[model samples]
Target: MMKQIEIRYATDADAVSLSKLIQRTILASNSKDYSHESLDLLCSIYGPEQVAERIKNEHILLCFEGVNPIGAAGLRGDYLRSVFVEPFHQGQGLGKLLVGEIEEIARQKSVSCLMVHSSITARRFYRALGFNVVKYQSSPEGPTILMSKSLS
Candidate 1:
């Protein structure tokens, strides 16, 4: 049988682990969509300090299997700020689970729509999840896809 994945809000103490997860996920999964310098920039932005601040400022959720986190996501207002599932943990619906959980939270708050600035690597994933691309922008980390899903 497959292990169960639990979802929960992130706490301050999870900053280091979460940051590491993000870094590893980005490096492993996004290298195809981003250059080395872009990956480095992403790693720097999602480091421990930033993770801690996000934990304090955003609604961040973690997916765990037997006390080990395999995925994480962040929401600020109606925007999905960041989402990452560990490399080994990908392709198991963890990313979809995270998005669903956050969308439910937004619905509870009466949010009319959900938005995300998706990494190029994740654009197809978001599109598969019912988000439409609004535009594209060049960033230090390569191209960013702006997407939105209506909750209504």
Candidate 2:
């Protein structure tokens, strides 16, 4: 049976756990497509400092399997920023749960539009969540998809 999980609002105190989740998610999720150096660079650019800022101004959600965190997500105003699930916990509907929570946060914030710069590896997940692709391009971070969803 699948273990129970909790979806809770995250605080600055939860940043470290969230950060580790992000790193673990990246290492496992994209190991087939990303070099170790590339993944390290990506995490460093979007690590604890970025997470701290999200905790300060964004609606951060930390998904826990008991005291251990299994996934993480958040919205910066109308922008869905982070969506990560620990490798062991992927494909178990956790990613969908996190995105749903972020969408709820956006609705509560009166956001009629949602946006995200989704990584190439994550485009399908967001697409499955109803975000429509507006464009695709290369970035210093690698290829990306600029996507949006109407909440109105």
Candidate 3:
């Protein structure tokens, strides 16, 4: 039997779990492409409190497999603030699922375009999802690729 997957709007109660999920996903999946200093900065950006706040103020979503969170994504205004999947869940299409959902949410909000500052490890993934590179940018976490997709 296959496990059922569910995606839903994240709540403040999900902050700790989501934070841990994001941190684990970054450390496990992006470590090869990002330096330790960059990883530390990325991990610090989504601490539990910060995640809770984002969930409250932004449209953040989480994906669950049998009551355990396996992936998450956040949208702030027209921008894709974050996307992460558990290392074990990578390549299972969960990332695509989250992105699809985010696009739908943006559509509902009448957002014409959605943007993302994708980590180098995820640039190809976003590109495969129809996002085009806008530019290369630097963040405190280090270099990032700016990508966007039109919702119209």
Best by lDDT: 1
TM match of model 3 to true structure: 0.96
Error of 1 at 119 (Å): 0.7
Regions more than 4 Å wrong, model 3: none
Once fitted onto the true fold, the runs of candidate 2 whose alpha carbons sit more than 4 angstroms away are none
Q: Top TM-score: which candidate number?
A: 1
Clashing pairs in 2: none
lDDT of each: 0.91, 0.83, 0.90
Q: What CA RMSD would you report for each candidate? A: 0.9, 1.5, 1.1
Prediction 2 TM-score vs. true? 0.91
lDDT of 2 by residue, 5-96 (tens): 88888888887878878888888787666677778887886688877777898777888898978887888877888788889888889999
lDDT of 1 by residue, 27-61 (tens): 99999989899999999999999999999999999
* Per-residue accuracy of model 3 over 93-146 as CA lDDT, tens digit each: 989989999999899999999999998999999999999999999978989999
The weakest ten consecutive residues by lDDT in model 1 span 1-10
